[model samples]
Target: MTGTDQQPVSASLRIDGKDAELEQRLDDELTAFNAAATGAGAPEPLSVRVTDAEGALVGGLTAWVWGSCCAVDMLWVRADQRHAGWGGKLLRAAEEEGARRGCTEVIVSSFTFQAPDFYRGQGYRETGRTEGIPGGHEDVHFHKVLAG
Candidate 1:
């Protein structure tokens, strides 16, 4: 093989404590590479937050928008505020924002012990599940088509 085809060998490896700078640099590099490879552009963050009259956080949803998809990373509501329907409102707002940003679908996952049925109530269909999480539970994935 030609010299140009030879892969460089790593001489050492070091495991270190958390470094924010290194984490940011790695994220930036990988994001650029993914954008270039998939033509999806860099993932943009989308969030929906709920607060009380005193501005105390009640619940929130966080997600990343890439190409035509919005992936919900977290959805949480204060225990006291949960059954009052804030979760649905937050999710609907996120979906609307995603549709406004040109996304056609949204995806989210929940642990079996968490809110798997909640997503279903919001019209998200179960797409898959990963078994054998602690305590014999599963990670359930869901998908929903945004209404334009």
Candidate 2:
């Protein structure tokens, strides 16, 4: 080749129309994968049962079983029904259910504004604590071993 002559040069740039579609499909797949992973690892939602003493559903409790333990998610009695042992009754019911489900222990969590001492009075021991959540609030965790 002469100094003034030029050799052939080859170059290519591919733009597939399906590339965007493929990217979108991959994104959808990743999203589905992430959701499935999270759902499979997350604990089940608490199951709740309510009771109406008269015309009002004043007493209720929520719980969930995890492995050999049950979590008492919530226990509430009406304001007017306090000090009537309804709370203990509800807790006992939840414990019975937990035992029936092969749970050997029960755990309950309550905020500083709720029934921390009440649980202690019912044979629950404070196992954990977290302070300064959100609006300057503290949470207390409690646990109790079930009777085999």
Say which candidate scores most in lDDT.
Answer: 1
TM-scores, one per candidate: 0.90, 0.65
lDDT tens digits by residue: candidate 2, 1-148:
7799987689877777668877979867875775586643223345545566565776888887765778887788889888888899888888888788778999989998888999999999999999987778789999999999
Instruction: Please state every model's RMSD to the true fold in angstroms.
Output: 1.9, 14.0
Model 1 lDDT-worst window of ten: 6-15
User: What is each predicted model's overall lDDT from 0 to 1?
Assistant: 0.95, 0.80
Tens digits of per-residue lDDT, candidate 1, 58-135, equal: 999999999999999999999998899999999999999999899999999999999999999999999999999999
Whole-model lDDT, candidate 1?
0.95
Give the poorly placed runs of model 1, Cα more than 4 Å off. 2-6
Candidate 1 C-alpha RMSD relative to the actual structure: 1.9
Top candidate by TM-score: 1
Q: Model 2 — TM-score against the truth?
A: 0.65
